[model samples]
Target chain A: MLSCEQATRLTSERQERSLTLRENTELKMHLFICSGCREFGRQMDALRSLIRRQPGDKPPED
Target chain B: MIPDSDIADLRRDMLAFARLQISDPHLAEDAVQEALAGALKNAAAFARKASLKTWVFAILRNKIADLLRSKYREPVTTTDPDCKHCAPADDQYFDDNGHWQQDTQPRSWGDTHWLADNADFWKVFDACLNDLPAEQARVFMMREFIELTGPEICATLELSSSNLHVLLHRARLRLRACLSGQWFGTEESA
Candidate 1:
């Protein structure tokens, strides 16, 4: 089982790399039972969405 | 075929991206103009597979690179190893067993979409972004707002994946903590 710290790190790591099956399973299992990290993940996603919708700036076509 | 209006739009987007990379407004404008000029010069070589916007943006990315290289050629002082976010944290959330500490567990910030309706939210956001240790802010903007690929950012900034991810992680954590305080209801003063 991944620790809260490790799971949090995985949250940001998802931005740069896709987790492997084992890594994904650990993260999902930890998140399923951990409300704080789950809430933290929700906030992170919401933050990204808001940052994406920031006016006058579209996602650079990459 | 290049339309003058299309050039104008390209310049606008290019300028926006350049402004994030370069501090001086004049320098940003010059970079954008120089990029457009280069694109126009190579107009015949354009494969037409990429959108005009993408083509122009790729050109502008190079232009920004050129300006950074020429205008600031010295060893970079901005990406300090010991900077706040770049350094390892003193207190981590997990104990020896890698489980959560009650005190360090993250707290929730309820529906934060009010940020869209409130223009001032951006003001707070900008301030918070600026408050981040300089290196972290640069990495965050390049990776997120400026939309550089991980490899591209690594090449431009000379960071390995692990180093870059650390900077990005710190940036997100710092920014989220700031928003949770100033924008959400968790501010210490509140």
Candidate 2:
């Protein structure tokens, strides 16, 4: 299993589309065994979805 | 004369780009207007260093920073009630026994659609972005939403590549943690 630090690093790098195949495989392996990191990945995906949904020029309502 | 259609198209594109950098919609509108005006006024000085889009974004970034600096002379507070339970000690939410607490029935990845239909999801998302330290937030916005390359971000922000990476990493980590808390009810683990 990957250490938390390694998993976190992979999580961040995943967003950049910069991870190698070997690195991605390793991250997936680690994620299978690490619930915390898996949860982290889910949250990251959720946040990405939310950010993408943000309207660029709509005013915030009072 | 520039056709009215072209002008409107430019305004729309600039507003979309500015929205990526500045999460606040009104601020994005203002930045887009200012950037469009600047680009027009300085049309003679287009030195071809980058694409027009990149150049326009650089202007928008500066304008957003100036607005943020003015509006937030004091640090913005980070007290959203929705995220109060996401503290580090709240790992119980993700613990083995507690995992089933919230409709724990596992669903296929494609089956989940809450974020798509829920407006509150974005409120929490924007709140998390706003929680980031100003500089970190700026770097994150420039790199991720605006899709600027690392070297470009470093050059634009006057930061070293390593510094830029570190800031981006921290910002992403924080956003991940914050969003997990708000969406998944999971506290950051170590």
Candidate 3:
């Protein structure tokens, strides 16, 4: 089982790149049982959207 | 024709972003000015595939790069091996067994959609972003704000792919902690 520490790291990294199949499975299995890591993942998604929506100055298009 | 107010806003945004990369305010101002000028000169050739803002920022990015190269001898600082601020904060949340420390477990943030229009919330968000260490902030902005690809960032900053990933991950984790503690987990302070 992936530790919360490892799970959270993958959670953060999921923002930057596609995880390997093993990583994705491991993260999914851990998050299924770990509310803390699940909440951590949701927060990561929230932060991404919030930062992107920041008013006044918009980031450049990809 | 883009209104003067819109141009002024873009200039302000460019200057703010430039100042983060270049220490001198005057130099940052000059770079933004030159970028706007260049964008105007080539306005005819601006293919509409990208938003005008994106095109403008692309020009500004190159302008800042030139200035950094000429003045600092490197367009962007590469990773520092022993930099104290660049160290990861993972230990703060996890114990020796790699489980989350009891006090540091993630908390539910409740509804977040309402925050989209909350100006005060943005203030806290900006503060958290600004509080990031310099290198982490740069990479985070490059990846998240500037929308650069991982490979593009590695090329631009001369970072290994692994290093870029680590910096970006660290930045996200820190920002998550800051936002949760300051806004989501507590009653509105702003």
lDDT, candidate 1, B67-177, per-residue tens = 665664454335535444366642344577766556545677777776654658877987889888877888887776556677666666666677788888777777866
DockQ of each: 0.36, 0.13, 0.40
Task: Flag the better candidate by TM-score, 2 or 3.
Answer: 3
Clash count, predicted structure 3 = 0
Give the alpha carbon lDDT tens digit for every residue of B75-128 in model 3: 445665544445656577679988867777778898787786676886787788
Tens-place lDDT digits, model 3, residues A1-62: 99998898788778777999999999999999999889888888876786566433332332
TM-score attained by model 2: 0.51
Best by TM-score: 3
Chain B TM-score in candidate 2, rounded to 2 decimals?
0.45
lDDT, candidate 1, at B30: 83
Of 1 and 2, the candidate ranking higher by TM-score:
1
* Residue range A1-62, candidate 1, lDDT tens digits: 78777787898888789989999999999999999778768877887777655433222332
DockQ, candidate 3, comes to: 0.40
Among all windows of ten consecutive residues in candidate 3 chain B, which has the lowest summed lDDT? B43-52
How does chain B score by TM in each prediction? 0.55, 0.45, 0.63
